[model samples]
Target: MSTLSADLAHQPGPETVAEGLLTMLAVVPVCLLVAGYGRGVQELWARRGAGQIVPPWRVAAFGVGVLTVLAAEQGPAHELAESSFAGHMTQHMLFLLVAGPLLAAGGAGLPLTLAAPVPLRRLLARWRVTPAVRRLRRPTTYALLAGGGQSIVLWFWHLPEPYTAAVDHPVTHTAEHLCFLAAAWSFWAPVLGPPRHRAPAPVAVLALVGTMLPASALGAVLTLAPAPVYPARVFGADPLADQQLAGLLMWAPMDLVVLVVTLTVFLRWLRQLDRDRPAGLPRTATLPGTAAVPASAATEGERR
Candidate 1:
């Protein structure tokens, strides 16, 4: 029979254990923030309208955010962080896909804004009314920040040194999480359209589908590569296995979710447009001036 000492020897060492604990410590504040903000927003929305309740999507989003943070801090996330390229990939997917959309749908930003002190809130509101803030509030800016920024971070950070550097430095690690969250928010913003930064329905749908391409391509490249791209290989395990798993995690489900949401938003927008069209006019002529007689008597007579 194998001795207890041999079994203990096979387990992960003290340094790895300490690293995992630190990772959990890092994740706590973000989780608390999400929970507190989510609860506050739900309550605020509930109070604003009679007989209306928090939507299921909002609840799901909040759950996703909390769970993702928990996973990152406690469960497979710690192992993945310490393990191979695949673990890191999986972490990215959770951050981008699971936590990203949920936080967006949950209106975490608005709540965070509301949670600020009164003076800060006043300042923010004032700033938001300014030209610069108005311009930044455009759908294009939201889409880029949520979609393009995420893709850029995902691709840029995969290079060898930066990935390792992130692991070695706590600040960079936090920044990495922030980037993921921001990108996820950006990706989801078009789909859910948070209050201050809503996009046109069509543009929102397009942005959602367009953003997933980069992650898919990157995943495929990593999956097929003959050699590892990241330098800090895991010591006591199979690096390639972790890499393949991470690639699949990053590529497959995230794209699927994006596609499904895009279809849903497109159909919903089409239905809304159809419902709003006037009864007598051709759908194509529903534009304001085209559908109505001009105020001028001469123009009205000419139409008749």
Candidate 2:
């Protein structure tokens, strides 16, 4: 146990700790602005004889998202990542699968936009329609960019040169982290924040599938390779084992994340259908204290 601990543990850098603290501080103001401004808005509405409580879930989710990023980038994982593949994989999983989706679900951008000064907000809104931004507004294009861009970043960075560069160079490592987070946010936005006019659930599921297959395939290849593909064999641990662990981390855990997210989206889609159904009848009719039956069968049984 001591040996294992030694193999995985490392001295946490002051710089890393500071970076984490700073990151937290950066989000604090934005969150405060949102809450404060929102409350003010509510009060303003109250004066006009109408008001609504702000949704707590969205705020909580955003907080969790920021914390996830903080934990990955500035926590023990970041400190140990250069020395241990497990640590690196831990950070990757947190950002790509967890934080990104949470932020999207929480409406991360909404808070900032709402909190911004009126003129700045107007300017920002206008900027959304630029040619480059317009390209991203299309659902199909958004999904493709998110899934494809993420896959490229994930696979490309894991290559020997880039992987080693990320481990050895601070700038490269920061860039790598940013790219992963950006790709993740892009991928998750369509899944979490879909346009009201279209059914985004199917597209979201497809985007997730697109992400899942490529990531799992990459992990499988890495696992099957006889030797460590990345030159980041820093710790005294067995290189082969470290590499294999990283592969397994990506393989099993990535699928699990995808599966869980897929189920969540599927359930939400089911709920949307329920919401859309007409008031006169339940689509899947169930008699009092009986199993749910298909509408046709239920109607026939009632007739009988």
Candidate 3:
């Protein structure tokens, strides 16, 4: 323990300094998007004399998401990750579970789009209507692709060779983390994005459940493996035990988080159904912006 502490407390080497600088550069986009969102909120408030353009919770989520990512990348979590498999898993979870959903729930996309330069925003508007883009954004297609992509990325990085390469190389490490962030954010967006684009609560529940199974399977594999799947040198104390701990970290909290979210969405859906129920008629869950529409109309609204 003392040796580990000494290693971490040592003065930063040139390589470490360079890596830190590179990391800061990589984080620039997140900061810019956050700034843009704030700017957009201010502009909207000025133009409309409205109270908050975004809900206070959403703004708070955005700030906390940014902080979570920064902490995972640059704070003590990063230092601890160098010597411990469990610690590395902790950092990854912070990126995937904590930062990802928070940012998705922040509703920053609309504001950032609003804050974009006029020409860029106009270009995006034009691009969004393109056949390829439209197809990609379809609820069913988007959900499947995003969910599948995240699963694939998660599994691929956990593979022995890729994991070793990422750990050994600074650039690859950065890329791996970026991939995790992008995949996580993309996967969660359909469930937690701005109301205009959020999927129906029932659909979100399905997405969450689908994602949970694969993650749990991965965790089970790690926890049950007889031998350490990763390099022994990369982990603290007993590598096999650390690997198991990492597995449990991935399996237990992840399952709990997913189950809780799924239940919340399910309950919300039931509440909506009850609230909108006519005395004797049955109705399906409606999309966020289509609550006033007939259930039949909202049923295929996602396809539209």
Candidate whose TM-score is highest: 3
Which scores better on lDDT, 1 or 2? 2
Q: Please, what is the TM-score per model?
A: 0.76, 0.73, 0.85
Clashing pairs for model 3 are none
Best by lDDT: 3
- lDDT of each candidate versus the true structure: 0.71, 0.75, 0.86
Segments of candidate 2 deviating more than 4 angstroms:
1-54, 130-132, 194-199, 274-304
For model 1, the superposed segments whose C-alpha errors exceed 4 Å read 1-28, 31-39, 42-60, 232-236, 278-304
Candidate 3 stretches with Cα past 4 Å from truth are: 1-14, 50-53, 280-304
User: What is the per-residue lDDT of model 3 for residues 204-252, given as tens digits with 9 covering 90 to 100?
Assistant: 7777888889999999999999999988777899999999999999999
What is the alpha-carbon lDDT for the whole of candidate 1? 0.71
Pairwise TM-score winner, candidates 2 and 3: 3
Candidate 1 vs candidate 3: the lDDT winner is 3
